[model samples]
Target: MHDVVIAGGGPVGLFLAGELALSGCSVLILERDRDLTSPLKALPFGMRGLNAGSAETFHRRGLLEAMLEASGADRKEVGADPDASEAPAPRDVSHFAGMGLDAGGIDASALPFRLPGPAMAGFMTSLEAVSTVLTRWAASLGVEIVRGAPVTAVTQDAGGVTATAGGQEHRGRWLVGCDGGRSAVRELVGFDFVGTDPLFTGYVAKVTFADPRQLPLGFNLTPTGMYLRTSFEGHLGMNDFDGGTFDRSQPLTREHLQAVLRRISGTDVTLTDVELASSFTDRAMQATRYRKGRVLLAGDAAHIHSPLGGQGLNLGIGDAVNLGWKLAATVHGTAPEGLLDTYTDERHPIGAAVLDWSRAQVATMKPGPNAPALRKLVLDLLSTPGGVTHVYRQTSGLFHRYDLGGEQPLIGLSAPDFRFQEGARLGELLRQGRGVLLDFGRDRALQTAAEGWAGRIHYAAGPVRNDLGFTALLIRPDGIVAWADDHADTEAFQRAATRWLGHPRTWAPQVGSGRVE
Candidate 1:
């Protein structure tokens, strides 16, 4: 038996394994892929997730530096560097001159912190980056990784959960399914995966750029009702994703490639090296049930959708960070198991929202007389300052906020990714396998309360980010402000903390785990 056994070693499962391992939980990951040690092999421009908030995850876990080292990517290096002399961000689409995506709101500059391990997300990088870094780092912290063992089913009771993997059974105090769209673990637990499936099949092919003039060095063709798109980078800095809907009966062939190049680039530039091409459909579904007995679902198992916003991959990984620590806290008997319930309560709605928006985008992309007009409206909004701000916030994942009620105003807001003058940035401290109290550099009572109960709760202080304002706050492991104190009201702050995390802040029974369950 293990403390936690995760099915599906995709981005979500890999991240969960790392979080659990880092939290000191004895965890094992069962991946169906043949190679256990291979880095995540992804297509050139596979947009992962689009949360500006994801930056917190990448920076906190030190994966930013990991990717920089692995792919030799410079943080300052972007497709559109105003100062680049030779290769530059793409400038135009077919008949659309200088058609470049304005990614001005994003902070492409590198911050401080050298990370103790490796980084994961980036185009031209591997999917295994997230898993490999977590696996190795988690193993160093004593987590185990098992590959090629696809989970066949799961059985659970109040005591624990047992999983059958490729004719073998593994028991654990709790089971987490990070498996992709079709989750065996979810099916075994009797959870209903109710959501929309793709009516059209899509293919993604990563072609090497031997010819520089094929397409401009920028984002997916400004989303103009033009031909298809070129390479688009996810806000997370993963792979470049480019490709579109394909006929279900027809396979992706050179003809399709020719047609795409002809429509967008106005050049019939043939490619010799097609590194990787994957054909899959969209599924905008979420499990009707997130937890059944001791078995729980996360990532793709919990939600799957059209990869329009680069959300599928990143959303799953985000679920890992959110659920892993909650489950570990529950198993350790610190917080109430109720905390785990929050995973579904919080993320399920987010999934639904993404599905709705993604479907709208796919609808807009439909080739028809109105398609051009629809695309024009979107681009017009995107060009405006308000539209640009909203677009970046929505697409970059920075605007993701939860309704988790806490006295701290920042509770639902993205945790302040402030620059730490003396120590590591506030974000880096969170990746230390524990929750961080933003402290906002105020309130002695929190220290007293935390000291009153040592080991279980931890605290750290940093000045608020210039954008966050002048107040002390406490952030959770998932980079959400669990509690914040605007003034020097220690008792009020402690009360808020108690309501948010449950004092002694454990997964104990009876007091509710901050969820409807």
Candidate 2:
């Protein structure tokens, strides 16, 4: 039996597959679509933004640079030079609702905990570029991809999961549904998807306009609806708050799109041709639980929200990263009891927060008397340091912290990318997909204690210029700080190690003293 059978071959599934295979787990990806290329995943329609956490995840796996390079985005554009004397050049800033925040107003200095490094907090790329890079990477790691085979049914018991696709049956120890919002696996597994419904039907299309100047240059919020025009020729987006009226199953036509555009833009904008068109809604829903029995769900299968802030992709990718390692460990027979449950506990709240964030944007963008005041207040607030910082932190995914419960302040947070005295950075060490026991004191006893878990954890001793308030840190494979202490104690270190790595078969010396029995 395969170690994992993933439904859907999108970026999230491919990423999870690569992670599992990196740790020597067999993965098989079942994709519905045979052709990976599509116009909608190309220019303006395919554009997506990667938040801080997603970018860092890619960097930890040594794939960020390659993905960016393939997308034609300059490395310098994503991050600033640490040694630069002058202010770093500004890139495109993120928006909440339809109002954009000023890039210059953001004060990065306020975020002292954020490390200075080459990794970016946010960057824009197309879906095609992301899928191309991840597909290649996953394939290189020995992940098997079977396209044109959609998962029609799924059955699971304590033993394993069985998925039926294209008249064939596949069995695996675990199953993860990474399919899009409308997941067949989730439906077959009978997961409870509970949340609010859609408020509007949104449209994104690539059209050949007879007269483009009739529309506004950038995003235009009208009394009736909203519309956006990008730098790409004839790429347009329109939002019609018709209480979710338009039929999504029906194919979109040029006539229908032109009518919608003219009505929303309040212009005589004529469309000559529609090269590509698609529809989405504000319907937000999340599975009550991420896992049931031997079956699990990730990406859109677990939770889905409006694409207002472009957070859907980022959130789904986060779920894959968080679940991949724990699930792999479980299959490898090394996970502590209840370790798999932590995925739902940690990521559920994050998903709920994103849903609320999108809902808030929709509320503020509604065309009504109250919306004007709300928008004005939000814009005014975004202009200030406090306002800008809050919005930046929320949208950038930098504020994410797990509830790993520990005395140290950095516990449950992403480990700071500290530069070691020996010239290796924390991100560099994480590339191998192993937990790290970072020690700045060069405690020989600590190294000895970690030897029992030898291949599973790496022991490194190096001094950092800025320790970020901690002398040592125990980082997980996913780059989260499971344990941290201001001052090293033998007992404390032992407890932390046992909590994450499981109790060593044979105990070693104390953290700072002589060997023990």
Clashes of each: 43, 0
Residues 369-425, model 2: lDDT tens digits: 677788899889887977877777777765688988876667887877777766677
What is the alpha-carbon lDDT for the whole of candidate 1?
0.59
Q: Quick one: best TM-score, which candidate?
A: 2
RMSD of each: 7.9, 5.2
Q: Estimate each model's TM-score.
A: 0.78, 0.94
lDDT score at residue 489, model 1, on the 0-100 scale: 61
Off by over 4 Å in 1: 37-51, 77-100, 104-125, 206-276, 406-408, 419-421, 440-443, 461-471, 505-517
lDDT of 2 at 498: 73
**Regions of candidate 2 where Cα sits further than 4 Å from its true position:** 82-93, 505-517
Pairs in steric clash, model 2? none
